[model samples]
Every structure is written in structure tokens, then in C-alpha cells.
Target: MFIEYLTNLLGTVYKVPGTIDPEKSFLELEVDSLSLAELGAQLADDLGIEVAEEDLSSTTTVAELAGLLESRGADIPA
Candidate 1:
């Protein structure tokens, strides 16, 4: 499910690069900051939530972002 979100966020076919856990840095996967922001907005839209602009800078992992969305009451897609 998470991987699907990432793929949609990046608009590409993203495979887990290694055994890297979701909590690890997206930098480890080489996702750039601009892409990450786009990901955040896409996530917000998909989940029907508003992700603040400031939060985008520090959301550095898939799990972290997911947690933020969850906290905002997003029904994370399974």
C-alpha cells in the first residue's frame, strides 16, 4: 500500500531499492526534495486532508509522512 502511494506520488514505477524500511530516510531511496513536496500534496489530495507547507520540509520518510496523514485522520489506503 505504501509503495503504491510512493509510485503514485512520483508518477513512476518505484521499487523498494533495498531492505530499507519505510521509517528510513527517503533520501536513502534518492527521492529529491521537490518530489517529496509533490508527494506530500498528492497525499493530501488523495486523503482529503491539508498538509501544511512547513511540514513538507521535515517529512523525510514514508512512515513519517504516513503518520502525519494518519494524525490528520486520513484513512490510509490498504
Candidate 2:
């Protein structure tokens, strides 16, 4: 669930340099802050949950992000 969303968002940003790894930190991806903010909004709207920009900023990996979404009642797919 979350991985698909993250992947698509990163793909749209045009700055993600390589194949995305769920375990890789967002810092490694080097996604611009503007893109991250936009992604945070999209995530909230798409998932029908409140995804804080700060939370997104501090997150370490795509998997951890999925976990956060699940914690917030996102019903992430296994």
C-alpha cells in the first residue's frame, strides 16, 4: 500500500537517483523539501489520514513510513 504510493511519488519528483529500496532512508534519496511537503499532502489526501510533514521528514526508511501509516489506521497491505 504505502510502498506503491511512495514509489510513485518519488518517481514523479524527478530527483530520486536510483532504484528505490524500502530500507533505504529518505535522506539517501535526496528528495527535495518541496517535493516532500507535496508528498505529505498527497499522502494525507490519498490515504485519508493525517500525515504530518515533520513525521515524514524524520522518517528513516520507506518501511518505517509504512509502519507509521499503519499505526495511524491506514490499513496497509501485507
Candidate 3:
């Protein structure tokens, strides 16, 4: 669930069409630090989870970010 949500959010942040690949790194996605910060804010606001920009920066991929959000207590649908 979080993966799907993150994928959608990443697409919005990156202004890209189609689904974002979970295995692709942020660098490969061409995400800059400013985008990371914006993504972090959006995650916190949308998920009600305190995701620091540094934490988001540390995440290598969308899947890794989903794992981090899961660890931080984001809801997982079954």
C-alpha cells in the first residue's frame, strides 16, 4: 500500500508520467535535494508520519522509502 502511494507521490513530485519503478534509485530518477525535501514534507502531511528530509535523502529507492515509512508506522493494507 505504501509502495503504491509512494510511487504515485514520486510521480507527482518528479512530474513524470506513469508509475515510478520501486527499484530505481532517486539519483536515477533525477531527484534533487529540493525535491527530496518537498517529498518529505508531503509524506509527513499526507501520511501523518514524521519523515525527515535527511531520512528521505538516505533512502536509495522508492521501495526503501516505503520500508522506512512502514517502520515509522504508516498503515499497511493487509
Best by TM-score: 3
Model 3 Cα lDDT, one tens digit per residue, 1-78 = 788887876776567556688888787777888888888877777778887666777347888898898888887433
- CA displacement after TM-score superposition, residue 53 of candidate 1 (Å): 3.6
Residue 35 local lDDT, model 1: 65
Off by over 4 Å in 3: 76-78
Global lDDT of model 2:
0.73
lDDT of each: 0.62, 0.73, 0.76
What RMSD, rounded to one decimal, does every model reach? 3.6, 3.1, 2.8
What are the per-residue Cα lDDT tens digits for candidate 2 across 1-78?
Answer: 777767766766645766888887778777667777776787777777887777888346878888888788885433
- lDDT, model 3, position 14: 65
In terms of lDDT, which candidate is stronger, 2 or 3? 3
Q: Candidate 1 lDDT, tens digit per residue, 1-78? A: 554465454445344445556666677667667766776677676777877766655436767666777677777655
Clashing pairs in 1: none
After best superposition, candidate 2 residue 69: deviation in angstroms? 0.9
Looking at model 2, the pairs that clash are none
Q: How many residue pairs clash in each candidate?
A: 0, 0, 0
